[model samples]
Target: MSQHTFLTLDEVASNLKVTRQTVSKYIQAKELNAVKINKSYRITIKDFENFVNSNSTSQEPSISYLRKTKNCTLQYSDKSDDFEVVHGIFHGELRSLSNNGKLTPNKFIFGDNYFVMKKLLETHRGKVDLIYIDPPFGTGQDFNSIDEHPAYSDKLVDGEFLEFIRKRLFLIRELMSDSGSIYLHIDKKIGHYVKIVMDEVFGYQNFINDITRIKCNPKNFARNAYGNYSDMILYYAKHRDNQIWNDIRESMSEEKRKELFPKNHSKLGYYTTNPIHAPGKTLNGDTGLEWKGLKPPKGRHWRYSREVLDELDEQGLIEWSGNGNPRKIVLAKEHKGFKIQDVWEFKDKGLSYVEYPTQKNHDMLERIIRNSSHYNSIVLDCFAGSGSTLRVADKLGRQWIGIDNSTHSLNVIQKSFKEDNINFELLEYVPLD
Candidate 1:
């Protein structure tokens, strides 16, 4: 491996934005190292860099300094000191409810997620691979079940609500592995503020996509605004480039199949013809050479080599039009599914069809879990309402941890898991002195 150049004491002090005396003090205290060169002191770049957390409260300030120096960052009141208040002393224990003589990775914790997630840091810090949370939007209203039973309240609004989510986010960031990703689903009314809060906690550099999800059918309400039919999901990764991404695609619908692949061959079935020549000319390659007394179209080149083009023709995979123009035949059945876009349409079921209030559609959970996580990875949902995310993770062969405070949510989860014959350890949070 290559090594960094050495620096003088004065150079190190200037780089650290501190006095030479402070740098000397750190060197004397062995927090940082320096070599005695001739009559002066010199420090290696690595040795000069080891004094990061010697005086600060945490490593976050150093990270913040580097980020600010390198890129633009968002700033908000109470943002710098917010984590200091919430990140301390988690006093709780995991009480396993139904273990089958083995320690199961899947867990269902019934408690306020703030303390429960902090408690999880002891065992799960930097271990979770994916998290999908559908937290209560700051609507300042209480949600009720179909029978008029109270489900949960979304009464916290504005700054208070944002702080509540922000505190949990700080702890959630600790639980996420370097390769982990989190998706937060919220309504448009408060989604924008939540995005800013997320950028603050997860770093603006790690922010990924603002996915618009069609949550319901179009509405014709008497309100002045346009019909509201969608919500947003803010996706962020612990580290942008390291996050797991499966690149799952969506299957083509019948209408799309008919529109794109209208022609049918007796042996090959539904297919469409694409131009054999693509844009951009190859100066001196096989793609520029003549084939079967025909040259590629002007200002373009053959999509394949001359040998491959002949093979395709021999295999009857090339279509010749009446004007003697040749194109490549693409079969619909052999086509890979279309790439999924940022906008999605997965409507939730009506209230009467769901087990709990605001229960999300399982298909949406399936898509998220399949795309952002892998089999056997740990998936977490601290704001698990009806346990849709946990259930979907189980179905997808991922170990999951679900936490919820509402008794109704817990009851719904228990009933759903029991009916589905899914085995999981149920834990209740107990405070410690």
Candidate 2:
């Protein structure tokens, strides 16, 4: 209940530019005061200051909070330095592929997304508000459309795949606004590793959710494992607690309504009864007082004040049992929809029903855009498979950008956009040499 006033050994070590072992030595030697709480030593700020002041020499600068808090990072064979990844050069240029006859913020880049994203950092850094990308799943296979057209390749595997994603994530983090968020759709096989990579780019505290998306129906494979029917979407914010979150809810279905609001009322339609008291006791409030000669149950407090409870009883909103137990009537119409959870069932259609291979569900994209962005926000999809994210963002009145290296993806996006009467510019990444 109190503000956090203690620091962990790791935090102290990071701030002092030393190791946890060194901080432990200071504690063991009784130089720094610390308390043992739940098997871990927690040093208070006052004591830490005392230790620092007592140890620092006149010639040395006083130490402040100089280092970042320790965080988890994925280690792979070819992982590059974060600084190098952020400053890496891409010898490519964005050239206009087509004009939409009007000035618009929406654009599609038909080129390698890595290079395209690097180019974007020059002007669009910290401008994009939301991003949703569904990259290849590293299955070591080639993807093709329903008509046998080559779509994209997923040749990178293991450490190579991880490094590839890590490099792009560094660039993506730079392109994100302070309040921006990104949702990465990935298969469960490699999603965990990618999550750690994201934690390295975006701090671990910025992670919002690991959404389990039911991508398809149960598979009848003859493997010694459970059916693979789902994938995961890793969601993270550029800065924790700052990204736009609309808290969109899912509408209740007729089946759920019948199940929850089973009782029918003549005037209030379908309704249900709820306990008038909540779990915690209120010792010095009106909720703790008696109402209608009845007090709240033991260890509980009235959900409403006694005056409000009296008003509800007078309005016939409180139902009384034969034994004098009372419950407030809840109308189904007054109930808001169910809160959307991490597990979603927006299944993708068959290959023949989609324009591109591995095209995601439109409803899923709609949910992501509606919840993570606003009308004026800029939505970007670097691995813009079938351009579903861009289309959804456009439909939701948000500006959008799409980037992909696959010509098949480009053609599919162009066709879909034209059919939808969406006006936007197109560009291509041309190599310099």
- Measured by TM-score, the strongest candidate is 1
User: Model 1, 97-122: lDDT tens per residue?
Assistant: 67545577788999999889888988
Q: 1-433 in candidate 2: lDDT tens per residue?
A: 2214666564576466566689999999999999886566788767877888788787554543222222244456765655556666768899997866878889999888788888899989989999999998889999999999999999999989988988898789889987899999999999988988776567566788999999898899898999999999999987778899998989878999999999998988999999999999998999998988988999999999888988999998999999999999998998889899899999999999998988899999999999999997999999998899989888899999999989898888888899888878999989897
**Candidate lDDT (C-alpha), each:** 0.83, 0.85
Which sections of candidate 1 miss by over 4 Å? 1-87, 100-103, 279-285
Clashing pairs in 1: none
In model 2, pairs of residues that clash are none
TM-scores of the candidates are 0.81, 0.79
